[model samples]
Target: VFELGDSVNQIDTKNESKNKSAIELLKVPKTVKNLKDIKKRKALANLEINSLAKLKALYLSLAENC
Candidate 1:
């Protein structure tokens, strides 16, 4: 569950629509193998993919909804 303070950053809390929207904005394929960029591939290989795109989208969604 999302905490009250978390909402200030637009973190979702079991909200299907918000999750869908965030994932769509990411434009990333379901599997890491589908990733094209070498950096992304390496990150995935290391299991360290911190997608700034997705984070931005989530923040935007939160800001919009807030």
Candidate 2:
């Protein structure tokens, strides 16, 4: 069911022991040198996913940031 980009960043494809599921993966950039930030990242992603408008807001927010 996944199209090109949909499958591009799926966490189900990651090793569970090494990566958070996509729902929580947004904050953990792969190159993070400070493990101390993981909790903060997860918390931020959880907050973003808590509501549809928040998710949409993040999507739009990231578009310009990118």
Candidate 3:
């Protein structure tokens, strides 16, 4: 009976470890996707800023000519 109990405990421990590893594996892709989304947003924001700066310059040049 004692040996049987020990064998069950070992199996439970292994199963727990496998479950934890699977959870971690699932989280990795979500983290990577979130990072990619953040990078894409940052790039869009930079483009908007650059475009506004160019428009401001053009407006100033046109006003000077007027």
Candidate 4:
């Protein structure tokens, strides 16, 4: 009964997750942009989205640095 609840159901059956063979694109950064776009009419003082794009960009920069 997988009704989309917890981590156990999300784990793959063949145990390939441990090897990190599959990669799923992240959702948070895009979500932040979408939130900003939806409330664009508001004043900049009201902006409060935590942009993960910088974090991801940093990660990519470090990846190439190493």
Evaluate all candidate structures by whole-model CA lDDT and list the values in order. 0.47, 0.46, 0.51, 0.34
lDDT of 4 at 43: 29
How big is the positional error of residue 15 in model 2, measured in Å on the Cα after superposition? 20
Model 1 misplaced stretches (Cα beyond 4 Å): 1-50
**lDDT per residue (tens digit) for residues 1-66 in model 4:** 112332332323222332222122222344766667534423221221112233334545766898
Give the Å error, residue 58, model 4.
0.3
For model 3, the superposed segments whose C-alpha errors exceed 4 Å read: 1-30
Q: Is candidate 3 or candidate 4 better by TM-score?
A: 3
Tens digit of per-residue lDDT, candidate 2, span 1-66? 222342213423322323344345555565646455666666654554354344445555676798
Clashing residue pairs, candidate 2? none
Q: Rank order by TM-score, top first?
A: 3, 2, 1, 4
Ranking by lDDT: 3, 1, 2, 4
- List the RMSD of every prediction in angstroms: 10.9, 11.1, 27.7, 14.8
Query: Which 10-residue span in candidate 3 carries the lowest summed lDDT?
Result: 1-10
> What lDDT does candidate 1 reach at residue 28?
60
* Candidate 2, residue 41: lDDT: 66
Output the lDDT of residue 48, model 3.
Answer: 51
Q: Is candidate 1 or candidate 4 better by lDDT?
A: 1
